[model samples]
Target: MARLAYVIKFVADMDRAVAFYSETFGFPVRMRTPFWSEVDAGETTLALHPASDANPAGSCQLGFNLDDLRAFYEKGAVTFSVPPREQHGTLLARMIDCEGAEVSLSG
Candidate 1:
């Protein structure tokens, strides 16, 4: 079976994107460079790549499971596209990343 490795997210600013994920999600930066970087996202690595015209920033959506959705949202680390709300008995929220990607969060 083929194992999944990295989920690439195109970013306009590598440093900003890396910092956002590291600070907001508390993910550790495994690798860092101007053109490419990687964050250890538990089972998989989230790769950051420089965006081009064809692959613009904010072209991807990422989902994360949080222990405290409200607390995470309250931190104000990133801008929220949608605030936390109950969905079918679970809490869900959407936040905009540094690159404007809408990240889904659930607790």
Candidate 2:
């Protein structure tokens, strides 16, 4: 069976975002630097990247099963919830980067 091992991400500030996810989610840092950081999510890898100042974020929701559900949205990620007819969930949010990379965070 084939498995999706990693999902590479792009962000504005590596240090800030890395610290935020690490402190908030408690996902250990697998590999990191100024350009990218790999988050160890046990079953999956959440790779973080820094986005530029000018760019529309892409369409891609990174669904994460987290312990601290509320804190995940506290990092200024936009909340998105369908009108009951779309999906069943109490929490949903999105974070867009300058390069048009979008991450939909759910609890």
Candidate 3:
């Protein structure tokens, strides 16, 4: 059987990216270094790698399930690409992370 491991995101700024995910989504930092970092995202880990020419920021899209999408969005933590709205009978929203990656949130 195959199981998921890590979802890597190349970030322009390591500190900013770390702060964004940790503070906004409350994902605890598993490890941190100048070149790499990881956040414990439930079953899988979210890895933050320093961005370079070959691996640029905003190249990944991630989705998360929140208890209250509206309340989360209203907190003004990150800039929203799409505000919370009903789509196919589900609440969905999109927000841009510190590294410019598009992240989807649902409740």
Candidate 1, lDDT over the whole model: 0.82
Model 1, 7-72: lDDT tens digits are 679899999999999999999999999988999999978989899885699665466777778988
lDDT by residue (57-101, candidate 2, tens digit) is: 332235444454466545445443431122354554445546555
Selected candidate, larger lDDT, 1 vs 2: 1
What number of clashing residue pairs does each candidate have, in the order they appear? 0, 12, 0
**Superposition error at 8 for model 2 (Å):** 2.2
Native-to-model Cα distance after best TM-score fit, residue 104 in candidate 3, in Å: 23
Which residue pairs come into collision in candidate 3? Answer: none
**Candidate 3 ranges beyond 4 A from true positions:** 61-107
TM-score of each: 0.54, 0.47, 0.55
The residue-by-residue lDDT of candidate 3 on 55-97, one tens digit each, is 6895554667787778888889789989999996999787888
Badly placed stretches (over 4 Å) of model 1 are 61-107
